[model samples]
Target: MCARSSLIAVIAALACTLPAAAQEPVKIGALLSISGPFASPSKDMLDGMQLALDHRDNKMGGRAATLILRDDQAKPELAVEAANRLIRGDRVDFITGAGLSNIMMAVYRPITSTETFLIGTNSGPAPVAGKDCSPYFISASWQNDQPAEVMGEYLTKKGVDDVFILAPNYQAGKDLLAGFKRTFKGKISGEVYTPLSQTDFSAEISRVRAANPKAVFVFYPGAWGVQWVKQYSQAGLQKKIPLYSSFTLDEVSIQAIGDASLGMFATAHWVGDINNPTNAKFVKDFRAKYGRAPSAYAAQGYDSIQLIGAAADALKGDLSDKNKIKAALREAKYSSVRGPYSYNTNNFPIQDFYLTNVEKRGDELVLNTVSKAVEKAKDVYAAECPMK
Candidate 1:
């Protein structure tokens, strides 16, 4: 009788421990470019994700949460190493934050193949959106080409016949140029792909000057954008040649470039001025928390956490079922700062793109949404994705 009683006590103890163990805080691993050229945008992305956590009182789905951050240094091999550590050592429930396409590409296979959810805050490489789409991989940001496609269509509508294009020689650079060509229907005077490491755009500016197209379009993000715009202004090309770009003139870059970025038009998925209750609250809270306007990078980062939280809520904080988490993410049951949001078949976002112009508003530069360039824009590669 005593043996049976002890067995009963052990069983009861085990049952009692189950719920406590189940209540373990959700662990999120974020790999960001914390100390590189991408640092500025990465910081904003981190801040945005942090804000989302703050909104939830650092809890998700009635459970405490822990965020483990790793710096990729904008290097592919380093990203892979960091991802391995996050997956093997930390055993994070979700891995988020890859600010560059190259870094995303490097870490995608390891995270997704393991069936661990990779909630990409930024960096939507094309292959992952198309033939290589994985159920475990979902982008909280738009595909790499979406913004450029918007810019292409916008410039085409404005009747720009010829344009010079430049971009850093990388996966995203190639993707952006391809997307631009897809919609522009314009003559390309000169198409240049500069080295990613190159900061001096003097040669590129000379090339642009020689091609002397009606307009110039480029996709330079982070510090690269700042230097490129500053040089372009210094060369006095902004006045002569109408400049258009995507991901070039953002709030972070605008602060660095100041008046140089003024009048420059770019295409993006979200701007601070986007009129929506969700965005209004995000912009207000982000400013209050960070003392600066959030960039599109920040918006995407913020959305990434919201996505994870929504999925956790759907599962009632039980993250053991990977399939259920993926399903919850597919539903995207949370409000997006960019307004209407849904996932494409490939797990990329089907969202809107806007034509944004950098302008001065009361001693501060802002990326103002001028017009809706594409409504509920879906990436061109969605049809190519094998996933249903």
Candidate 2:
């Protein structure tokens, strides 16, 4: 009788120890440029992602979610290798991230073929929005070209013409200029493509001066933006050429450029100017936690995790049941930092964009909105997307 009673107790303990419904951690992988030219936004991305995870108590639905990360160093080859490790070795259920468009492009094909859901933290190239749209892939952020698309309309409305364009000589660089030209409806004085890592821009500045365009638009982000803007200011062209940019400067870049970045105008899909209560809390919490204001990149990174959690909760965190989880993701039912956000047919954001100017707000650099949300903003290739 004693032996039988002991066996019964052991069985009861085993039952209690078992996780509900065989719950295992839903694995996700992130490939970011944590230690390269893209480090500024990369840090923001990490913080934003972690903030969302913390908000969810580090669990999605009833199952724990695990995120494995690897730094791609902002290099194409490195991005591909990192994707390989995540997909083959770690066998992650999903993959996300890559700040630069070139690095995202390098890993695109391999990731799509893996049948793993790949979410973008940033970096949206045109091909993915159009022909490359896959059932397994979704963009948690706007396309690379969308910001430039908004800028194109803003410039056209402002009656600007004869603009000079500058970007790196790469696949994404070419796409960015093409994106601008697609909507501007103006004369182009010149379209110049500098090498991806060109440090000094004295020669390019000289050429731009000779061109004598009405305004100069650039797409340099991260460290490149700092160097380009610093040189542009020192060349004494800040006043001569009304500088406008898409992704040229942000909260992160402003610190690097210091007072030189003031008065520069840029456009984005998200910013601290969003007056929603949720965002107000995010800005306050983010500043308190990281000692800095969150950029759009950081905001989006934070939103993506919230998105995943909302979907998982709706589906009762049943990751093994793919259909239910995918349906929940499609619904996109969550209070986003952007206030209202939903996925287009191509699995990209169909949200609003804004025109923002750089300014010092009480000793802290901030993006001051000159215009409110430009509604119904669509990517240049939205028409090409069959899903639409």
Candidate 3:
């Protein structure tokens, strides 16, 4: 009788342990330039992502959720390797990454093919939004071209006829110019494509001066933008030419240029002052948490986690069913910081864009909205996506 009772207790203990073991937490793999020039916004991404996770006690769909971070160092090969480790070694349920288009492009194939959901918070390359789009992929952020197109419209309405375009010779840089050309009725002179992360802009500024276009548009971002803007100001080009850019200057990098960023206008899907409950809460919580103003990139990162959580809930915590998860993702049901957000057929965001100008307030330089340039903006390449 003693032996039989002991056996029964052992069976009951095993039963309890079985359920606990089966309830393994869901894992998400994040790859970004976490330690290099892009580190500032990478930390912003983490802060935003963690805020969403904290609201849910770091669990989704009644299952614990874990975020694994990998620094890609802004290298394409590093991004590819990181994706491999995340998908194979960690066996993550979702993957996010690559602040730059070239790095994202390198890692895109591996993640999607492994049946993992790859949601982008930033870095929306054209091919993924167009013919090469995958069912497993989604973007919580605007495509690379959307804001540029808005800036083009803003410039056109300003009575600007011809303009000079400058961007890096990369997938995103090309997309920036392409998006601008799609909407703006202007001549693109001195169309220059500098190498990615190129600092010295004296040669490019010379080209801009030689062309002597109505205005100059650039699309450099991060430390690259800081160096270029400082050089542009020193060259005295800002006095001669009105400077406009997309993704080149934001909360993350503008302060590095001090007063040089003043009066510079740019375009974005979100600014610091959008009046809505979701945004108001985000801005407040972000400042309280990170001790600074949040950028559009930070908002996207916060939204990405919310998106994954929503899909997980809709699927009843069953991430094993890729088809159901994919369907649930398309029907995104969450309070977006952008007021309202929905995916195009390509699963990229259909959002709006604002014309923001850099202005100073005592000791702080702020990005303030001039006006809304486009409403319910949709990407031009979505129509080309074959995903049904």
Candidate 4:
């Protein structure tokens, strides 16, 4: 079946499972980092979210869904501006997107402070899931650091110690390294936080080689990820020191990075290959529709709409009762493509994480899920959350 028909069937099935309800058009405010370094990945995610909506006939809970999107341009000020536009100008019922953790942090307060339900398709910041948890903020994605934790666990199982950590200097990067540290007992040879979008990793590579750690763990996304892997290969570091990353290498960038990313290992909640019925349908349909494999970001984007649709149906499309919508999200009335998932008391999803390796699938180099690193893992920060 086409991706359209398959998604329609899945989302329609979800609507049928929920108690019937009716209301006016549901307005969704999406704040996305649609340009700059993350442009390609963000577009993939947007397409994935839109594809699900298209298949479902753009209706949820018998009410039409109207998604109003604003581009953050990968800037904090622009993110705030977009949040204000969606909140004050469009008066959206639910807010989604802000693909990057930094952008999400900028927009979250402005959107959620007004009590509009926000579902994170990506960017599950640590504090938001911990001490700063909110009843209305639900993450349909991951808790930012779970992948790193999974990688850490994998590294430990492999008997590797003394690794180097590299990431952009931001809250998400800090959270990622912290999570890795939590699981990894090895010594940290070099913990380097580079400036945002600074592309030059020559110095960092030099330090990594000099330090000669057992492994290198990085947390760069989108174009940043591609550049790092390519440069690492150019520096001839990939062949000597195994590079591990979280959300840094995937289908979207694998082909771009090509030989550089071959054998590169990364961790993510969803990968292109998973032997599940839901994922089978998603992979086949996405490939048929887009002529390429779906990245984890694409899966997250698809799941976000599935979640919102399910919750809206249960709440009868009247998302004005932000608390009720929040309750629906917490219940997770929809069947996620990644399989079973429910919100922890902190309103972040407790999901599985996996290990993937970049390998050639035909002419394309892709990140394939090869092992389950953490099964039904829950973040430790859940205890820090007072929301429960």
**Among these predicted structures, which one has the highest TM-score?**
1
Worst 10 residues of 1 by lDDT: 15-24
Candidate 1 on 67-94: residue-level lDDT in tens?
9999999999999999999999998999
Residues 272-359 of candidate 2 have per-residue lDDT tens digits of: 8788988988888898888888988889788878777777788776666655666777785888887887688778888888899988
Q: Flag regions of model 1 displaced more than 4 Å.
A: 1-21
Query: Candidate 2: minimum summed lDDT over ten consecutive residues — where?
Result: 18-27
Q: How many residue pairs collide in each prediction?
A: 0, 1, 0, 0
Please give, for residues 293-329, the per-residue lDDT of candidate 4 as tens digits: 8888888888888888988788766665666777788
Badly placed stretches (over 4 Å) of model 2 are: 1-22
Against the unseen true structure, what C-alpha lDDT does each candidate score? 0.91, 0.83, 0.86, 0.85
Q: Flag the better candidate by TM-score, 1 or 4.
A: 1
Q: Cα deviation in Å at residue 30, candidate 4?
A: 1.5
Model 4's C-alpha root-mean-square deviation from the true structure amounts to 7.7
219 in model 3: Cα distance from truth in Å?
Answer: 0.4
| Candidate 3 per-residue C-alpha lDDT over 1-388 given as tens digits, one digit per residue, 9 for 90 to 100 | 9999999999998878754423788788888788776777777787788887876688877789889998998888988999999988998889976777888899888889888889898889999999989999999887999888998988898889899998888999999998888888978886889987678889999988888888998898777788889999999999899989998888878888989999999999999899899889999988898888888878888989989988887776777778899999999688888888778899988888899999988888889999988889888889899986
What are the runs in model 4 whose C-alpha is more than 4 Å off? 1-23
